[model samples]
Target: MKKGTLYLIAILWAVIVILPFLWALRISLIPTYTTFVSFFPKSLSELSLVNYEYLLFKTKFPRWMINSVLVSGGATFLNVLACSMLGYVLARKRLPGSNVIFTLVLALLMVPYHILVIALYLGLSKVKLTNTLFGVILPLSANPFGVFLMRQYITMIPREYEEAALVDGCSRIGALFKIVLPQALPAVGILTVTMFMETWNNFILPLVMLTKDSMKTVTVGIADLAFQTLNTNWGVLMAGSLLGAVPTVLVFVLFNRYFLRGLTLHGGLK
Candidate 1:
């Protein structure tokens, strides 16, 4: 009875989480005139791919999609690489001000990025990066949480592995590249998915930084669609949102095992 109740609760939770996406999916497929009161569309004739067609061909959405892919992928790559190196140094090597550095990283985790928006915008504007793709990517690339997560995961790795490599006459860089990195793959995967999701879903930063529609990320583009005019196309908006979610969904689906493994590091150690 308890097991059945638990399963019921889990199913309910799953429904709660997924129902919104399903509704959006339905909205995207149905005609803009069709009301959303039923489980599916009123009739087959009421459904079409017109919203997707408009989003793809008629708007700047394709450019936004390409820009989002580039920005998210680039930021994820840079964050993972830089975090791994900084994390390895912080985890393995004792250096002056290491504690202070780690503490600052942790402190930044508590500080919301929203607080820095104006400051970031002004700084990037000064550097003439405003309205550029790199303007969005550069600020998000070196997140402190990524550094902290990588640091914690690297610390969990057995130092004896690096020690063994050093005994084989491998230099620090070589050991880091050859030994530590392979061990940190799970953490790297987690950071990749995480950064991609955050960067892809980031609306405010991009909206503020990017003035040009051609350079806007998908989130910003979709939002601009919402606010650009009074008579917004709900169907296109839903379709754009659903399509924009695809890459992040794919990333999570592909790397979910690694993401879970990264989280369970301390569980095994304890």
Candidate 2:
């Protein structure tokens, strides 16, 4: 395709991807009654902060936001720490049954998480972990995709770096922190952003694990807002959704450089 054609396609795709958020933003700014009346506001005068105000002050939205942050942030940190160590081991250690372990990890990537929900609920129930943030965080803390990503990226890095560190009397764990992890920043950024977004936006896991109103994450809380009343409050629901989406957006923006660099290197763009 021509360069101009490619640019046009890219622009169109961007618009397509952004339209829903734009609509949500539009709806969020207007009165709930006016939501279905038109796509575009008749005038700027129609816009108001009432929805945002109500969502913030008059509901459990703030508590839910805190819950989401705690759960998603905890899950992301654990995934990075666990996956990094496991990936390094699988890539460099050559431990017994390591190949079999990796194959099982690969198989896990093909298994849909939905199927595990029942088992997860049962096991957590047995441990009396249900209805707690830890329960939600624990299930999402380590991802097979994260393990696979880290292992593949770590393999591409030269062993000479860690070997030099080891010769300098650095412990194996020290070398991982001082040598391997620094070089794996791009992959770590990718893992951080992806895991945070996945956990932040997760609905099913939190919904099942947490039955208390105060323990609900932003996703489940917004869902409650949508169905809590006989008539749905579009304005408040959209407002909650927009706010709920902000963290993921900020996380992506903060780590986008690493994400782009990782993609470029992995894709041979340079």
Candidate 3:
């Protein structure tokens, strides 16, 4: 393709991706009743923060935001820790049945998690974990993709570094924490951002696990706002959506460099 054609395609794709957020922003600034009156505002005076104010103040949106943060943050942390250890073991240690375990992880990547929702709900209910933040976090704490990415990235790292550390009397765990993990920072960044976004935007799990309004994540809370009454408040719903998207955007921005570098390295390795 020509450079101009490629540029045009890129611009079109960018617009396609950004159009929804732009529309939401526009709707969020106007009154609820004015949402469908016109796509473009008639005057600058029509725009206001009334919807934002209502979402932030007269609703449980703040609590929902807190719940989302706790769930996403906790899940991300556990994914990083658990995936790293599992990836390291699968990549470096020749434990018995290690190949079988790795194969199972690969197989899990093919399985859709939605089908397991019933089992998850039943198990959590048995443990009295329903309607709790921890229940929501636990199910999202580990992912097959995270383990696969970490293992692939870790395999590319030089074993000589860990060998030298061992020769210097460093314990295996010490070498992992000191030598391996630091070098695997790029993969860790990718996992962190990915897990945080997935957990933050997750609706079904939190919706099923958390029946209490105070424990609902932002996504579920916003969904509730949409259907809580006879007439939907478009402005507030858009406002909540816009606000809910901010943290994921911030997380991506913070880790973008590492994410890109990890993908590049992983692709190069492949």
- Taking the tens digit of each residue's C-alpha lDDT, what string does model 1 give over 1-270? 699999999999999999999988888886574553576766788679999999899999999999999999899888988888899889988999999999888777777889999999999999999998999999999988788878988999999988998999999999998999898887777778778878888989998998887899998888887775777788888899899889878877888876566446423332
Per candidate, the number of residue pairs that clash is: 0, 0, 0
- TM-score per model over all chains: 0.88, 0.88, 0.89
What is candidate 2's lDDT per residue for 1-270, written digit by digit as tens?
899999999999999999999988988888665525577778889899999999999999999999999999999999999999999999999999999999998888878798999999999999999999999999998888888889988999999989998999999999998899999987898888778877998999999999999999999999899897688888889899999989888877888776565455433421
TM-score of candidate 3 against the unseen true structure: 0.89
Local error of candidate 2 at 200, Å?
Answer: 1.1
Residues 139-213, candidate 3: write the lDDT tens digits.
888788888988988999999999999999999889988999999987888788778877898989999999898
Q: What is the C-alpha RMSD of each candidate to the true structure, in Å?
A: 3.2, 3.4, 2.9
User: Once superposed on the true structure, which residue ranges of model 3 sit more than 4 Å away at CA?
Assistant: 1-13, 35-38, 258-270
Model 3 per-residue lDDT at 263: 53
Best by lDDT: 2
Please list all clashing residue pairs in model 2, or write none if there are none.
none
Span of 10 residues, lowest total lDDT, candidate 1 = 261-270
Report residue 199 deviation for candidate 1 (angstroms).
Answer: 1.3
